[model samples]
Target: MNLENLRREYLKGGLHRDQLADDPIVQFERWMTQIIATNIPDPNAMTVATVDADGQPSQRIVLLKGLDQRGFVFYTNLRSRKAQDLKHNPRISLHFPWHCLERQVKVCGIAEPLSAAESLKYFVSRPRESQLAAWASQQSRPISSRSMLLQQFEAMKNKFGKGEIPLPDFWGGYRVKPQRIEFWQGGVHRLHDRFQYTRQADDSWSIERLEP
Candidate 1:
């Protein structure tokens, strides 16, 4: 296969500075609402990037479970690799690949653990199976076989036995308080339109157009 031949012009639309919101959180909400209305698969999905103590970087896709002025929120095992990385270096980045709409969003921020009450609120709202899975699997850890994992899952099911599955001690969520946000729109001839919003010390945002 000739990879170089795979090319297509982006003609979806253009993003302009005048069209952007002064607050990036508002801008992100606007885009998210539009995408949600379009019924795209996993519209809440985002790629989270983190770095470990030694400066090794890693990335993973996580669903955006919550979003507001406080920033983006997602859950995971506290012992997971991404969580470990975040514990070492609170700096994190998020990417929303809305390629189906020829758009994307990038976020740079600090990752902080959510309050226990907040995590429990979302945790109990999850389906029973998901709640059990949280207790069954040791995320980012190697397992000898699929069967062994399934066995643990089954064990969790029996242990719960129709009772409410309490949130695991090692499971919770984090909020990414964004310092910078960028919105990108696909333009014809690869001349994409990009706008960046940076947070100021006064808790306000400054917007600027960036070259694509």
Candidate 2:
């Protein structure tokens, strides 16, 4: 497979330092708004990377549940691999790949569990079916077969039987408090534009442009 010529020129646009918002969170929201306006599928989908106790790393795609000054938030089974990893090591990274816009946002931070009240608030907003499924699946665990999984789902459906499903004890959300964030915009001739925002000791952000 001689596939050395698989590439496309990024002529969409170029990013200027002046165009960036003073606050990275504000800039992230602006970019997110543009992405949502377009037809791009799952605009909030992001790659979350975590490391195990042994220092081995793992990555997975998760939907962004909430975002604010506190930081980015996502929910998952508290007993999942990612959750276990976070328990051992809070350090984590997140990457948003907005390929259609030729833009990317990389975030590095520590993962902290959201309050039970906060988790329950989002849990109740989920669809009934999703709520039931959340109880049935033991994420990151091996399953016997598809039939067995569906059986568990069916069992949960019957148990709930039109009643509001409660939040699973082993399920909740995590907030990533970002220490650093980098925004990248693809440019022609492989000269990309990159700007990084680092959190200062006084909670202020120090922005710097990095060479591509």
Candidate 3:
């Protein structure tokens, strides 16, 4: 496949200062609404990047389960590899690449575990099979075979026995309260539009343009 031959103009849109919301959160919500309106597949998907204890970097795509004015929230097993990385270094980054729309948003922040009650609420809303799988999966741990996972799932099923499946102590949600949020819009000849909102000491935001 010749990658260079596949270039198509990124004429989907443009962003201007006059059109941007003064508040970054509101600006983000507007873009989110546009994504939703365009009916892009899995618009909530984001790449979560973390650094391990040894300063090694890793990243993977995760669904954006929840968000609010405070921060962006995602859930996973606290014992997973990414969770271990967060345990060592709470500073994290998230990227949303809406390629079809030629747009992206990057965020960096400190990650902190959400309240236990919040975790339980989301856990209870999940399907029964997912709940059992949550209990069965020893995330980031070595396992011998697929049969072993099935066995564990069956065991967990029996243990719960049509009862409430308690949220595992090792599983929960984390929110990344953004200190910096950058919005990127692909433009002609790679002259992209980049605007970043940096949090200030007084809980205000300072917006700036970045060289692209």
Candidate 4:
């Protein structure tokens, strides 16, 4: 199969500077709302990129659990590779690929661990099976077999039978305080429209257009 032949032109509507909100967060929220309205699969899914102490970069898809003025939030096991990387270096990047809309958003920021109380609040809201799975699995660690994993899951289910499953001490969330955000809208002939918001000293944002 010739992979180079796979190509499609994007002709989605262009993004204008006048359409941008003064705050990047607000603009992001608007885009998210549109995506959600379209019934897109896993609209909250985002690619999180982190760098290790050795300068090796790793990326994975993580659900955007919460978003507000603070920034983007996602959860994972504290001992996971990504978590460990963030522990050593808080700098991280996030990418939201809204391909159906021919748009994407990129965020660069510092990741900070969410408070225990905040993590607990979201944990309890998750489905019971997911809660149990969280307790059973050691994320990013090698396991023996499928049966062993199921056995652990069953054991956790029984342990928390007929009661609330407490949040795992090792499982929690991180908030990425974005220092820069870029919104891209694909245009005809591959000439995309790109606008970037850079954080200012007064916590405001300065918007700039980038040549595509």
- Candidate 1 clash figure, as a count: 0
Summarize candidate 1's per-residue lDDT along 84-197 as a digit string, tens digits: 999879999999999888999999999999999999999999989999999999999999999999999999999989888998999999999999999999999989999999
Deviation of model 4 at 100, angstroms = 0.4
Check candidate 1 and list the clashing pairs.
none
Q: What C-alpha lDDT, on a 0 to 100 scale, does residue 173 get in candidate 3?
A: 96
Give model 3's TM-score versus the native structure.
0.94
Question: What TM-score would you give candidate 2 relative to the actual structure?
Answer: 0.98
Name the regions of candidate 1 deviating beyond 4 angstroms. Answer: none
The whole-model lDDT of each prediction reads 0.94, 0.95, 0.92, 0.96
| Model 3 agreement with the true structure over 76-137: per-residue lDDT tens digits | 99999999999989999999998878999999999999999999999999999999999999
- For each candidate, give its TM-score against the true structure: 0.98, 0.98, 0.94, 0.98
Error of 4 at 63 (Å): 0.4
Looking at model 3, residue 109 earns an lDDT score of 96
The lowest-lDDT stretch of 10 consecutive residues in candidate 4 is: 5-14
The number of clashing residue pairs in each candidate reads 0, 0, 0, 0
C-alpha RMSD by candidate, in order: 0.8, 0.8, 1.4, 0.8
Q: Give the alpha carbon lDDT tens digit for every residue of 99-202 in model 4.
A: 99999999999999999999999999998999999999999999989999999999999998989899899999999999999999999899999999999999
Candidate 3 structure lDDT? 0.92
For candidate 2, what's the RMSD? 0.8
| Segments in model 3 whose C-alpha atoms lie over 4 Å from true places | 1-6
